[model samples]
Target: MTGAPTPVSPQQIPAAYQQALRLQNAGQLQQAAQIYAAILRTRPLAEPCFQLGLISARTGRRAEAATWFRRALEIKPRQIEIWTALIDVLDGPERAKAMAEAQRLGLIPSDKSAAAMRKALAELETGDPRKADRLYRKALEAGGDPVPLRETWARALFDRTETDAALKVLAEGLAKAPADPRLLLTRASLLETAGRIDEAEADLLAVLDARPYHPLAWLALMRARKQPPGAPHVATLEQRLPEAAADPEATRYMSFALAKALEDQKRDAEVFAHLDRANTMTRRKFPWNFEADHGFLRDAIAAWTPRTRGQSGAAPIFVTGLPRSGTTLVETILAAHPQVAAGGEAAVMTPLLHPAVEAWFSKGTDYDAQAIGQAYVAGMARKLGAASRDCRTTDKSISTYATMGYALDTLPDARFVVLERDRRDVGLSIYKNLFRDGTHRYSNDLTDIARQIRLFDAAVAAWRKRIPDAIHIVDYEALTADPEPHVRALLDFCGLPWDPACLTPERTERQVHTLSSVQVRQPINRGSVGAWKRFEGALQPLIAALDATRYDFG
Candidate 1:
């Protein structure tokens, strides 16, 4: 077919293969595939064939992927990676045969250290950091290569809210491979959380300098700083879109990045266009379970017992509210106080509530309140580590509304700061961003987002009647408009001394790993107070579904 393939140079092929890998990793799948195919045309390279198989398998073309992988195996019969790819794309007898052959050829690493390292990573995914740490120690003791798993291990530590420990892990990783893109990106994220934006920017820039088209790095950089008009990144992001279409992950990152870039240039229409497409895809993939969530809230409220806070190690201050309703903002303000630890999105309660909800809903049984309080206190203290000592931990867990009344008995000494915002503004913010953590299905649809707000309102109203003294209502609009008096009152309610530092939450170095991370990094301002007015007509469906009152939506 091509006059002996023009006698392609073997040396030229490996460089092309690497360039294809960089493109694939960056999520530029279409371009990556073109190069891979071109390389295959010249030489039937096992690497390109295997990569193409992987791409096909990931995109759900399993049969085609299997064919490509088999073709790759024909070139290098004992190629372990090719066999692995074939196994994943095959089913029934073929998969079993492939698996057996792969094992026979040592496809899966069976060594103790390798197995331990693998389990350590899996444990991290399942949120068992203790188990992961144990496994990691086993791997290290067995002399496994730590460099490969360093980024993941550091992220696990960060997930536990052990920021210092996470940074220490990154330091060790960077010491070994200072220019490792993955480690640098991870450390950059950590540094950003630590309020070292300049350092984070430096790390991101270095990564980009090495691999200019990395989508995730571009997304991270986009969030860290403004993408001004005529900036090289703006055009690069735009041009990368057609190529990124085949990789949905790449498409999502580039879409959001480009949207942010356009917004920086005041291209409102284009910004919304990109957000709409990206959020639509996100909603499709991560649909929120609205009914189960609200059902739990209702049951928890119905099954509420009039109990007070227990004598706790450190009094828990829960900043409860809807997403994008200034919950993190309030927590940052409170965390500025010397005696408060910033516990962003405390997840300790999530597991406890699910079973509690099921028991209450189906069996009319109540979860043990005293045990919940004790467990929450102990777990939260462990999560915050040294910061929990003599400090009131401000846990801005967004779903605390579901169990605030239950906490009256379970978490008796816990102070609840009920943060409220204008429904319209909340709607706008939630619609524009993809919530990576929130299993909030309601956020996918405009009407559902509106309905959820009213549910939150009703829940808070019920809590106010039951536990008014324990609840401190903070109106986000009023607080942002005039912060000093509200912050003083907020601190007084939690029995904390007034630190003027709370007045400037932007200066607070608390880690905010949420959609509002970038916005909350700035000083409190009324800029977002009524920003919804700018898009009123486009958001009419959301407005109509709010069951609007002049007081509520206006």
Candidate 2:
């Protein structure tokens, strides 16, 4: 074997190199490179060199990559693949150069269709959607079976808020690929956005019937159920919850749907149970609360929060708590006020803290409190996107503020209206509703749901002890019973002028997408206050831990 490591043939290595090329095409770059490297150790090949250049171009290694492409072009002067790979790695000026070279070498046509697609993809990547749209259209005009081009065009249109055009594109695509689940889901979402809830629901159901485990179908179905006025559909949703309990995605929508249904029935405990389940499952899947991993979050808030501090302008109002709690209702009420823009579940603050969290993981250091605060404000501004300038103040009702220690620290000048519903009600509501995301950790089991509630309650109590002055605890029972007094007090806390509409959140036309979507559409009813008492027989375990005497609401 020693001397025979002699002259390894290119034929002997082509199999491995070809396999590497396949891997590269399939988006498995690193593995392909390793195989290519192995082959190069035995023999040099033009195909592997060209493929390596393509991989390098994709991964942003442009300079070193040009050398590989040149070497491949030299070895196979007439190869179209080498010329294409070289052009792919080039920037604007370099692309022009490569194209000129290809033309001179007679390798590819100057205005070939592949060239247009490459240019279009590059434009799309650089954020020029309008130009990219035109290029994609051009690619279709020059082409073969323009369905893929239509799909991309539709997505771009949707991104640019041309919903009607987007719908038309996908609707036509659906005519061709009627059974495609993704197309069906997209078409349904567009329909829902266009306020055709009935049509959306039909398409969504068609998708689910074909692919039973489709999570988006379940969520769209839940949304559709909310739009309609009926108990039968809600009952159907309730039955489907257990069927979808095991899948985390399914459980979210199930918990959300169940909570909405139970709330409509004025079953407070059941509503709370389903809502809490949705929250638990969501948190378990993706731990959004930055404070859970850092005690400094609690510490930062206590230190940074000034006793006599006030916001300069109308400050951002945070309506937050457990998922099934009255966070959405509180926001609906608050948003009815002329001064506030209700920015639903602003997902900004968490992402701002992520890099710091990751740094802590890497460097074994503590999170910078001042940096976090600045980042939070900036993050909120970013999520506000277009609406940041529209209103004097905005409201972000992210419901996951049960772990608000860090978020409170970040927005020291902001006002918080913390909604506190009964623990049993929270748990029951969470268990039944299908939340749209994986944040419902308690969706499957009763025991875990209750434990998560206890955790949230403890966290909130700790926040009260730490920063009591910063938070206004709005009891769900009190809010539902006499909404005006609480609503007025909340308005006062936010430093806003009151409107009577705050007491009647139902009349607001702000697209309420929460468990209280239906309830918030009605007059504040007293029936929901202690309605969980009816289910006391079924919720014994939840009641045992959630001492009714402590709340003193009887």
**Which candidate ranks first by lDDT, i.e. highest?**
1
Q: Write model 2 residue lDDT over 446-507, tens digit each, in one string.
A: 56566556655665676777667778889889888777888888888877787897877767
Task: Assess the local accuracy of residue 80 in candidate 2 as a C-alpha lDDT between 0 and 100.
Answer: 73
Location of the lowest summed lDDT over 10 successive residues in candidate 1: 1-10
Clashes of each: 6, 50
Model 1 misplaced regions, further than 4 Å: 1-148, 156-165, 171-180, 209-213, 307-314, 548-554
TM-score of each: 0.76, 0.57
Best by TM-score: 1
User: lDDT for model 2, on a 0 to 1 scale?
Assistant: 0.63
* lDDT for 409 (candidate 2): 48
